[model samples]
Target: ERLALQALDRADRLGVAGYVLGIARELTGDFAGSMRCYEAALKLLPNHGAVAGDLGRLAFRMDMPEIAAKFFMHYLQARPGDLEGVNNLACALRDLNRCEDAIEVLRPAINEHPAQPLLWNTLGTIMCSLGDGVTAVTFFDETLRLAPEFGKAYHNRAYAKIDLGDVEGALTDCELAISVAESAEDLATMKFGRATILLALGRVAEGWKEYEGRFSADLLEAPRFTIEGERWSPGMDLASKSLMICAEQGLGDEVMFANMLPDVIEALGPQGKLSIAVERRLVPLFQRSFPQITVTPHRTVSYEGRVYRGAPEIEDWSAIDLWTPMGTLLETFRPTVASFPNRLNFLVADPARVEHWRRELENAPTGPKVGLLWKSLKLNGERARQFSPFMLWRPVFETPGVTFVNLQYGDCSEEIALAREEFGVDIWQPPGIDLKQDLDDVAALCCAMDLIVGFSNATTNLGGACGAPIWMLTGASSWTRLGAQTYPWYPQTRCFITSDYNDWDPTMQKVGVALKARFPMA
Candidate 1:
């Protein structure tokens, strides 16, 4: 790549040379340099700059979706109604967190070019991202109708079907995708998709086996598990060796996976040592809960002499004999539904903190204190399904002898005020607590509450882990497994789901009635 860049530099053909240099730089992973070279090439070629498409692709790679969208627009202007260009622009918009805009960008193109499978596929992808999986399935079906041989469409359609409670359809799509996959990466993706659907359907043994495909060729850009040691598998006896369970994904996932810590500890016995890698913010909470195991933050310092934010950085890598991702624990510990070691008090909150919150709640009106969360921090497509407007929770708010407390994280002061004005109710925001940062306090707060009612987010997870009485108002589809009214992981966290996608009216009324019965005034 460096030799190619040097050769392109020496060619000195001005416009074309600069464009070739940009491509060479991008190949060598120097995205900033590539952008600069592309900009120089664009200046040299002006109105006839053929590098617009390349620039758009480069910007999209760099996560500058707005800039990518602008470049795609320019490229589309030169060649209007280009199917690939339209799809690229919509994808850029989707990455920018503008799903509606992405849909709008492709909808006109789809009508104009009715036979284009790529347009329908792109629209389906965007709708899936926005959590409208039912609608996304229709779009994906249209794509398949146009291009039956498209393996990517099959892979995407599988996800849409999973969200729509059609596991059989999803499995069929996965089989179709696997059969038509042209590359090793595509094959791995189909396998992983099949694994997720299998897990959701309670086929744990096959799902766990298929899940090994997550680390397949050319799929993960970085090491899936950062711990540089032998990965612990089933049959590897941990009773006499040191084992590390490295955290994967988000905070909620970490907490959910930690439910199996007791099982791991029991498996290891008295002689073995157990260590865990979790998010930095969760260190205190995990430490307080599990005093037997060593807890460390999972952050990494990259090879480029720059710290990679949110990547797990193993502090002491020498002592651990075997290491595995926390998610992988489910394969061995919970291979069957009956094997799930359900617990009431797996996570212990600080008693001091619990008392502190208890005293604060004492001054409030004497009633059933409830915590509520309406929105997630990041409003991705699946999360959009979990949302319930403040107005929709009116029945619960109007219930007498109930003191509502705000547990929704992020800047929701405006929402609180709006609820007060519109519903003639006030949700008391607790003083001196950052809901996002303070998991320990959040756990204590959950303990302090009489009940916690919210969507499927971090707060609900925290409460569920703490054994607090929590009623989760969920959407039709959830990775947390919502086929049952009660989750196997957390016995206290009862789930009340909407009958159809985004229809909260019936669910809300059920919750209101439940609340009245649970907290009837004498």
Candidate 2:
């Protein structure tokens, strides 16, 4: 790369040299530098297809889909015969939620280059995005048939199979994906994908260990922990040791992984001590729940399009005997289904708030006080498909003898209003609670409800952790369920696993039936 840059001293192939330098910068994780070099290359040679394609990919990775799509379109215009250009353009279109446009873009390429595995793979991905898993599976099958060594197709097939209610098939595909993967980057990501499948298949022992691949440097994503200490591992001496467990992942995942905290505490013994860094909002809750363990809020900051999590509160890293990402503890403690304890109220909410919510529920004239959370606030990409529409929650709202409490945090006034206008049901908003900001009080409010029903989110996870009866409407083969009908992490859990997102109406109907049976009408 340095030689290519020096070649610019001769003023020969200046655009190509700049492009080479861009690639070199990209390889070294200097995306901003890469962007500058690529832009310079494109500015020098307006018709450079390779530079355009690379710029499009980088833009896509940086979450600039509009700019990416523009570049991809330019690249395709310049190099119409390139199967890669067609595939990339289609991918960008799909990211923009222009699936039909993506299909139109891909169809000509697949027709022109019928044997190209990537074209077929792109088609499969687009179909998967459309919630057409059956069709997506077929496309993936064709992609794999054309090129058996193609790793990404196998990984994608696993994802499609998951939605098709084929956990066993997904697991098989995950294994094949790992075996066929060529790059360290691909292998790391494939292993992480396999972990989800293994856990979904109830193979917790292997799943927990493989799950660490998420933090692998080679993987083309960032959820990196900035811990400054000797990382704890399985078989580490915990007795009389001072350990720090820094939380990882999203709020729900942090809460779910926290099932192992009590085990860590007990293993540490009375002489030993523990400290934890959780999400800032969760500091109070974690401190109250685990009085024996010191709790501090974790710091998360995004820099140059990368997320870094750290526990900065402990200035003296040397003071700690060992530190580990909280998720890693699962490998040591929860090896199998039987290894998980029937833990209850592991996250103790504020007693005063709990009593206050209980009194509020008591004042309600009749029927069960059912707390409801339908969808996650962060509905990005495929996640938007995982949740049913508010209109589809009709049967759930139709349930008799139930006063629905709106536990959904984000601006759910639209849903609340719809329930009143369409279903003649008033989903009551609990007073004095800013549902999103007041997560500490949310736990207590969850505790007060007779039953909490929702798709898996931070609040439902909190409700489950606090020992509330949570009927979690989860996806089929959700790894968090650990391949069980019951959520092993929480003591009080009743799962309603939806096999297909396209048809969650029947599942919601079942939930209504179950709800009616649990708390029959007057």
The per-model lDDT (C-alpha) reads 0.78, 0.87
Evaluate model 1: give its TM-score.
0.89
Q: 362, model 2: CA deviation in Å? A: 6.5
Query: Ten consecutive residues with minimal summed lDDT in candidate 1?
Result: 302-311
- What CA RMSD would you report for each candidate? 3.2, 2.7
Identify the runs in model 2 with alpha carbons over 4 angstroms from their true place: 4-16, 43-47, 62-67, 77-82, 96-98, 359-366
Clashing pairs in 1: 129-381, 130-381, 131-381, 298-312, 298-313, 299-312, 299-313, 300-313
Q: Model 2, 1-522: lDDT tens per residue?
A: 788779777885589898998899888887778888899999998988889999999998877777999998889889976888788888888877788999998887889789999999989988877777889999999998999989999999999999888999998998899898988878888889988888989999899888888888876565778888788988788998999988988998888888888888889998999999999999899989899888998999866556788988878877789989888888889988888887776889999999999988776647889999988877644566677778988888878879999899989988888898999999887988988878899999999999999889999999988899999888887888888988888867888888886678889999989988898873
The candidate that wins on TM-score is: 2
